[model samples]
Target: MIEIKGLHKYYGNHHVLKDINLDIGEPGIYAILGPNGSGKSTLLKSIIGLVNPRQGTISVNGISVAGTHAYRNEISYLPQIARFPDNLRVFELIRLIKEIRNEEADESELVNLFQVESDIRKRLRNLSGGTRQKVNMILGFLFDTPYLILDEPTISLDPVSLTKFRKIISEKKEQGKIIIYTTHIMNLVEELSDHIILLLEGRIIFKGGLKDIYGKTGSSSLENAISMLVDKNGK
Candidate 1:
């Protein structure tokens, strides 16, 4: 379980996260939806111990994230933008990551699943944007950790790749993995997310299921419901 309480962060004089309190004790896809600069990435980073909060506490499986990297072993993070050495081949990057983690991962099946098998020998600079995103996705799931944190992973995926991505997500769900992602695509949110964490201006205005959102806003569609909630609380 990931528990967060009274979480606060600041960037100089600007407040980023404001008294954030949340608990993620279940296994499912949780979508963190918000406008630009709404502290979504900051919150995710805090959970992974990349960003420390000025106040409050974060605990994963009864272990405090403060001053500890031990909790990171159970987490797999895929940032919104992954920068790699331009000269490195796809397979070389994969091998490097596996070595860093010191864990045996059979990326062969995943490489084929993402249909990037042929591109493994090519350098990162040679791969297209979409293909690079596929490689990022492949690395994210290769660990099979209990927790997966992704930041806008589907930015450049084609329809076919998106379909395959959804398939893998469902498979992960079946394995009871806790998947948390941030995306602006409402269609993906409507289809994949089991829970929603809506933040606006560094505050969580809503956190519940899609059905709960529909009922709250009295709107039939997820997009409309979210718009209503944002409009209502944004002021």
Candidate 2:
């Protein structure tokens, strides 16, 4: 379970996350939806210990995230933007990550799934944006952790790759892992998310299942529902 209580965050004088509280105990896909600068990424980063909150606490599986590195080992995070050493090859980077984590990995399966086996020998700077995104996906999934966090995961993915990505995510969910992701793609959210957390101006305006959101907004599609929320909030 991921527990977040009274969380608050700030950047200089600007507050980002304010009095946030959530309990994600179920093993399913949870989509975090919000407009830009609504504190979605900040919230996710705080859970992963990449960002520090000014108040409150976050814990995963009863382990507190405050001032600890062990809790992070249970999480696999895919950031919105991934930067790697330009001189390193794809396989080298993968090997380096495995060594750093000092854990067994079956990245070869992911390489084959993403059709990036041939590109593994290529240098990082040589891969295209979409190809790099595929590599990023492989790296994120290689660890097979219980908690997965993805940010804009479909960026630069081709239709075929996107389909594969969805299948992989579904497979992980079937294994009873807790999955949380942030995406602007409503269709993907509608198709995969079992629950939704809608944030507005650093606060969660709505948090519930897809059916609940639809009922509240009186909209048939996820995109329109979110639009209604934004319009109602004057965002």
Candidate 3:
């Protein structure tokens, strides 16, 4: 389980997150939604211990993630955009990630799943934007770790690739992994999430299942409910 208490982050005098408290358990998908510059990304970074919060406590399965090796090995994070070595080939990138994790992986399975084998020899600089996103997605899920955090994971994906990625995420969720996805796609949230956390400014305005959200907002669709909530809060 992942627990957060009194999480706050600031950049000099600018506060990004305020008194954030959340608890996420195993075998569930949590979709975090917020407007631009609402501290959504900052919260995700803090959860992964990539950015230190001014005041907070974040732990995964009883282990603190702030500068701890044990926590590092248990979580995988995929940023909104990824940069890879321009000279590295597709196969080389996967090979490198597998080697870094020190885990033997069936590279072909991942390659076929993402449909990137034809471009195995292509360098990162040569691949298109969607292909690079696919590569990034593969790296995040390759280790099969307990926790996965993906930020706008489907931004540049093509329709076919996006479908494959959705299936992969569903499989991971079924495996009892804790998946926290930060995305603006409400349709995806409705289809994939077990719960949704809605944020306004730096505070969480709402947190609950889809049915609860609909009931609260008097709307049946996820997008309508989110729009209602965000608009009401002046987001």
Model 2 spans with C-alpha error above 4 angstroms: none
lDDT of 1 by residue, 151-208 (tens): 9989999999989989988888899999999999999999999999999989999999
lDDT of each: 0.92, 0.92, 0.87
Query: By how many angstroms RMSD does model 3 differ from the true structure?
Result: 1.4
lDDT of 3 by residue, 157-208 (tens): 8889889988988998899988999888788898999989988888999999
lDDT of 1: 0.92
List where candidate 3 sits over 4 angstroms from the true fold.
none
Displacement of the residue 129 alpha carbon in candidate 3, Å:
0.6
- Which consecutive 10 residues in model 3 have the weakest lDDT in total? 64-73
Among all windows of 10 consecutive residues in model 2, the one with the lowest summed lDDT is: 226-235
lDDT by residue for model 2 (123-191), tens: 999999999999999988989799999988999999999999899999999999999999999999999
Candidate achieving higher TM-score, 1 or 3: 1
